[model samples]
Target: MSPFAKLLLVYDGSAEAQAALERCAQLSLALSAQVDVISVVDAESANAHCAGLLSDLAFHRLEELARSTLDHAVRQLTGDGIVASGYVSFGRLNDVVLRHTQAFNPDLVVVGHRAQARRSRWWGSRSAHHELTERLGGTTIVTVTLPGT
Candidate 1:
């Protein structure tokens, strides 16, 4: 039996995420693992950055974008003859992902990691991939990194 029976993929429609999706598809086929894909809408950050009315509009748009991104990912996987599930949520990236990770209890978590800029890294906030790896003790985390565009 394959060691990984279930897989969770964190996708955000980025080029890095597309690469991860491709990688996840290959892994799923090889292991015959069940796959769950997720995209998060950070509505809290949107509200904090925008004014009242603007915040509402931005949050709505963010949700729409997240939903579409996740749907497209699921469709792509399905087209490849892989049965997968998709989820869209609003919250901090790592938090939302962790919540789903707990619920899904995947044997493996696959996420695309784009290295943050020096300025952002200097701020001391870790990337979602970093946080997820730390928070998910014992669960195998596979991070696919892509060079900056």
Candidate 2:
């Protein structure tokens, strides 16, 4: 395994993701790596119930929120002298993450893993974290579980 030169962090504005961000910041500082924070907006879920009720302005607002979330994460890391940048994309979470990973070719990617819910288990219990770990060809995947279980 080569030393990490670039790190990609998948942020979802969750507590778990924030924990992962801290870990990434530590690693980036230790290894002197560049960090790229990405947030994927699940537009499918956003449009599911609302459908046409969501105006173009509303969609743009959501995009702005995503960008702001990523920017905040980047600021947290960069404040400690870690090189960082942020990006936001609207699409399937796993697909967008994978595509960005391919484009950036980062040495490592970090994500947060949520506990499997009972409903999800009954419905075949799969998640973007699993697909990302399995399908991301060259990038190493690091799934951070929240502290205290």
**Model 2 alpha-carbon miss at residue 115, Å:** 0.8
- The local distance difference test score of each candidate is 0.87, 0.87
lDDT of 1 at 23: 92
Clash pairs (backbone) in predicted model 1 = none
Backbone N/Cα/C clashes per model: 0, 0
Poorest lDDT segment (10 consecutive residues) of candidate 2: 49-58
Candidate 1 per-residue lDDT, tens place, 66-114, comes to 9999999999998888889998877898898789978889998999888
Off by over 4 Å in 1: 51-54, 147-149
Point out the worst 10-residue segment of candidate 1 by lDDT: 50-59
Tens-digit lDDT track for model 2 on 89-108? Answer: 87988889888888989999
Query: In candidate 2, residue 82 scores what lDDT?
Result: 90
In terms of TM-score, the best-performing candidate is 2
